[model samples]
Target chain A: MTTTTIQQDLYPTRTGEVPGPAIEREHPTVWGSEADGPFDAAALEAHEQRGFTILENFITPSEVDLYSAELRRLSADQSLAGDPRVITEKSTGAVRSVFEVTALSEAIDALSRDPRVLDRARQLLGSDVYLHQTRVNYMPGFKGSGFYWHSDFETWHAEDGMPAPRAVSCSIALTPNYPYNGGLMVMPGSHRTYAPGVGETPADNHSSSLKEQTVGVPSQEAVTEMAHRYGIDQFTGPAGSALWFDSNIMHGSGNNITPFPRSNVFMVFNSVENTLEDPYAAPTPRPEHIASRDFTPLR
Target chain B: MTTTTIQQDLYPTRTGEVPGPAIEREHPTVWGSEADGPFDAAALEAHEQRGFTILENFITPSEVDLYSAELRRLSADQSLAGDPRVITEKSTGAVRSVFEVTALSEAIDALSRDPRVLDRARQLLGSDVYLHQTRVNYMPGFKGSGFYWHSDFETWHAEDGMPAPRAVSCSIALTPNYPYNGGLMVMPGSHRTYAPGVGETPADNHSSSLKEQTVGVPSQEAVTEMAHRYGIDQFTGPAGSALWFDSNIMHGSGNNITPFPRSNVFMVFNSVENTLEDPYAAPTPRPEHIASRDFTPLR
Candidate 1:
């Protein structure tokens, strides 16, 4: 059949029409109507209600060491110095994030396809899943910066052309996360609401936004209302721990001023059925390393 | 409407079933049923019959100088040393190609949107067109490499998930295209046949194929037969001359042993009606720089 017809975009952001962040009902908290596979009943319920679930000891201590070593090697690799996939900190010039980790390393690619991780993603997305984006985020001890509160789907839908929030992100901690060392903070139950950010997304926004996001961030008033309604929860855990969260949930992290560093391997799994199309608001989509266009399911 | 249903792949290749190159009927040389715009009747008919058309002195001499200077500056940019968008020769470290030229330079971006070029693309594709890929290919004086005989749509369909052959490529010469130097050679009337190549496409094929294509190349017998039937034509012209050809035509070039360097800015325009989906043969889609996933029509 001919597919010349272009579908309408469901979630729109960065249109510059809204004066401030506007909250709207989400498409669906959980796409998979029934829970199965490795996810337990409580974990699935928590994911549906609170928009997130934490799994302790997702990897062994030795596995964590392997991943940490890989991350360190990737950070120090001189070959990736000026590559667009390697993002450095704004002030310190230290490697802040390494995008497309799976494509760059075979160890990470294997982990992405591991049934332990892949099964849960399939259960959550309610269909076969593909890697939307994968990266290793590093926050060095004293000079690491902070990320502002924002929904990933906002930027993804506006800039990357993601059709829906039928995607999930799993962050596997490679270093210990303490309360003072800039652990991730999420507004529980915020996944039920979609906060549309105000402003037009500039061309090549990812080059800057990945360093320090100034656009597609929810207004302070909107963040306060959401925080008051659901309350904020910080994810503090040991190495090898994992946190699975919805794509549209309100989340951010504070600066790390302590003596300890925090690093994590983040992987986003998107439903194969919900592939990308044209951008809804921005002039062009982000690079493939940041938002992958490949929809081949992880085997 | 929910798009959970995955469509059937129209063109399948690299399945390891075909023993040799198989020629099949093409979908359509001209999708735009009715042609109207800047193209004259003869030019359009030539495109339909011969699968290519050449416009002499498409850009003024001064404009050619401007583009040549831009291309030189881009080639010598130290900032793009290790960038994935920049490809260098396998033998020599000399820069060979620079992908995403429009995104890297404002002058080239404006050239891509010029009505003289964009209007013809829309007229031939029979719909609104978007920039599918743009790059500046440079073959230096002595050590220049040559491309093997292959149809681009085979790779685009097998690896980039381009559904149809409704795409056109415009190559504007930045330097003199002498017969001695490496210049594009095409078989007239070859675009009407879809020649399926043999062998399986390896994973991450673009990393190596971009430098020297070893896979997805039509057999030597197939090339000889096509050359005997349609006859081989070399594109030899002055700077600023432009050649527009169908995407699926059998084309390749010989190595430049001459002192004259041949350079051209290549721009590919795809019908917006034919956007990307999952790859039909390969394991993953190529990077966005090589094969764009964006479907936003040029306005």
Candidate 2:
């Protein structure tokens, strides 16, 4: 299932134009051992029911170290000045996120296009998937703020014209996640219900550091009720563990004001057949790095 | 038992010098109805056993409204520049704390020295009590960060030279405490066991906003073990409900990024007999507002 052909020129094109169809495959290719890669029928069934699945040892320890080192270097780079793709914390100028990682680092790009990852995406999504976004979130020590409780599809549906939640995000941990360090907390079976959140859009949705904080997060009443019905679970493990979640799952993380750092590489894959159209009257306000206009399906 | 002689000059004196003997009282004066105050033999027993007690309807609705209005005015005043008592959030510049509220606002001062409040303090402390600190915490919407899991006695013992944990804080809620709005969470029976935390002291111990975050908070393993043993409890109720907690109780608050504002008035009373002696060789690092050198007992 591994292919050498890469679609580097497909990005930065005009808005509303879909890139060409990806190289087709006969069947989903399985990779890794049974312990790590649960890319099987049972795994797909669980994802369909629960809206999330964890893949242990998705990458080797050495691979995680390499990715972490590359991320440190990319964050320290001053070349991408004033670029929306690179965002920092409000008070301390620590880099909070580096979007579109595929366009920058070769190692991260190669990892994103690994045959095993694409094969799993193909199996669950049940169609050819394209790289929607590649983000590296750096939850640095003692200063990292938190994302409020929200579902990804709510923002995508309200702001970007994502027709349906035919997408999934693979969050690859670059550091060991502990309870005190503020790892991701998700409510089980929340994806089964769609909560059109009650709020207006924030002024700038593209920025990693959300200053306005007007995004449609779950209401306190809703979170309390949902939490009561389906208890919350925290995602905590060693580095290289991968969490694949549905776009509509209710999730949030606490502020990381501890010594331990929490960093993750998030790659969002959208089914090529469910490509987005802008909901706004004007041009898509978000930059290419955040909400990509390029719908180039991957091989 | 109400004496009006306030000791405003006792502060700014040398750290080791006890100001003077307090106005002595023969027996503890009881106040409030049997249902609310519980200032009896059983009440002291409960305080000794549980380390915290909540006095429902501690203040009338009008009193809460008056204090809340004065607090709003104090927070809006721009003329208090260079005043170490007024501290703001490091990132947003929103007012996080206004220390020594008794010295700044008469309404808050009267509330702090109210007969009912003093009577209750006398019953549990078993001696004449002095005002250690008076602070109004303003957790405005969308910007309030959190205080990590820690005991107040740990900081007061290490930095402020508070000998034994013979102090209590009466937190009067200025706004209705809801769960999502970052109400305080305390571990029941935690005051019985002191957790020797692991960390260096923060540079600025006076500021409410923890920019340095070097204060010794409970470790992850300790919190986990204790949480399993005695589950955490959140304090939630009407605006006027007062929570009286021991200084050694393990407690912390969540971030208040929600729309609901969480404002509270915390009045810490130290036993006159257990007055501080400087732990450090140099003079007290913190200002008088945060840690008073005054030993004059309250009437």
Candidate 3:
């Protein structure tokens, strides 16, 4: 079959506001061809078109194992030592997140600075990038909670004083992301439309536990419409797969009632030219782990 | 001596642009004479003019003891548990702050709801007040840190989605705020100015240990000029004393490299009408302790 026929068969565009002409063209599933290195013009073009691109086998299996081991070690140390950065669910004590992982673990720090990630960040951002923040998010088995539909740039700009949405979150999968394991789901082309919604959520002890403050959570109806129009994409991959996504992409995950763990390390790379100032004209309201102030450019 | 003379003597108008006839007239040094409750017209007027009011002996000694004990217990419990909200100085391990104190301690929750604080908050804000957030700040002896000059409104408006400066921070002194002990110092008429300064400061781990993020900090020259024009007022008082100040008033503290604790419990009451939306249109970037999403009005 022809590539266009295959594309049409695979991704049947749902009827709605997304025009028919837009769907006729092929959207590249994988970022780079087998011949391209980690950073390339094709990857940038795909990212510009779809607002996200998954780089298959970005890290070797051995490297993934090393990064996974480092994360587990850090998580164990933080949990054991009662590190203030470690936020566990109040009810289950399931590790929800551990922030500033690069600061605490030398191995993770080295991994963050690796050319494979940083070089691509530079290419995508079209400038030197700085580490906005780093965190290891653990979606544990059984009680792993799901996040509501939202765009991260909305919060970063509103809260962190980020001047623009010129940033990307590089999600390096340390574990296999399966269909039923509550992996990330993105609405393709949703980045073009910046949905404006902001409100507070009910306090949840099992996840994002601090007061459950939220912003820019698109309504269920709106999200459904957007998903139908844009088409939903699941980021299911092996441990070494990597996804580089724009900050403003509409995304969320399902509850991982599954038995396996779906852990990933996310490094937010903000462009040097797009560094944010204080959102509030007061002392930084957030702790460094939540919104970092260090704007030192990554080499 | 006459009350006017005492007022004039106690608060001599510092040289500079506080305005003409306003400076000449005797500002009420005290709010009520004898038979007034916590919420009074005079108290509001004083607050409007000078941006603060000293509610003398708002809490009885016994009540103070109860709240203080509860704070100490909660602080100890959180420290022992390594609560993520409890931030300690990296070098000294001295507790810099314990956030969301009302969530953990019943005594504090009750104290926050007390008529003395809430009723006054209602009066000042011209609307029912909701609990914005609470913290027990520990300015430990010797190693206690100092904060830079900035208006709380700057943060509230920029970071927390607070629409207006319709908020008051009722600071109940847990320990005596002595001059040498690094207590709060306010620029008497700075609320009217709303000086717009935003930048990064020299990293200070002793206070604001998270990221040392700050905004609208008046330049040293401006601060010197403001201090010279509007003389600084220290909120030094006995243990049972309470001071209610406007959110926009520029204030800060000194380094308690001194041998005394200047701990205080600050309950921020935001006007219901002026409740904050998200600073950005995204998922809440902040953990709840810094900017609460709970808009449940204080009964």
TM-score of 3: 0.43
- How well is each residue in B1-299 modelled by candidate 2, as lDDT tens digits? 88798533211211222312221122222222334443776776666666788877888899889988888898889887667888888888877788899999988878767878887786667778899889898887656777877777766766677777788899999898865456787877777666655554545644642432434565666666666666666788899999999887878766754456799899999888778877432234566778788989887
Off by over 4 Å in 3: A1-38, A78-82, A200-214, A280-284, B1-299
| Stretches of model 2 off by over 4 angstroms after superposition | A1-38, A199-204, A208-212, A280-285, B1-145, B148-151, B154-161, B164-299
Better of 1 and 2 by TM-score: 2
List runs of model 1 lying over 4 Å from the truth.
Answer: A1-8, A17-21, A33-35, B1-299
What does the lDDT come to for candidate 3?
0.66
* CA lDDT of every candidate: 0.83, 0.70, 0.66
lDDT of 3 by residue, A1-299 (tens): 65554222211211223322222223222333323445556556667778898877988989888878876786677344677678776568766677888887787788788988887777777677899889887777545656666777666765566766678889999888865456787877777666554343222211342313243355555665676678667788999889899887888765553345788888999888878775521223356777778889986
| Per-candidate fnat, comma-separated | 0.00, 0.03, 0.00
**Model 3 per-residue lDDT at B228:** 56
TM-score of 1: 0.49
* lDDT tens readout by residue for model 1, A1-299: 77787676556576674634455664766666444578777677778999999889999999999989999999999999999999999897999899999988899999999988999999998889999999998998645656778898888888888888999999999998865456787888998888877788888888999998778877666776786687777787999999999999999875653336799999999999889977777899999999999999889
- Expressed as tens digits, the lDDT of each residue in A1-299 for candidate 2 is 88798533211111222312222122222212233443766776677667788888999999999999988988988898677788787878788788899898999888877976877776667777888889888887655667777777666655666666778889999998865466787777777666555544455654632432344555566666666666666787899999988887878766764456789999998888778776431234466687777998887
How close to the true structure is residue B107 of candidate 3, measured as C-alpha lDDT? Answer: 82
Error of 2 at B266 (Å): 12
RMSD of 3: 24.4
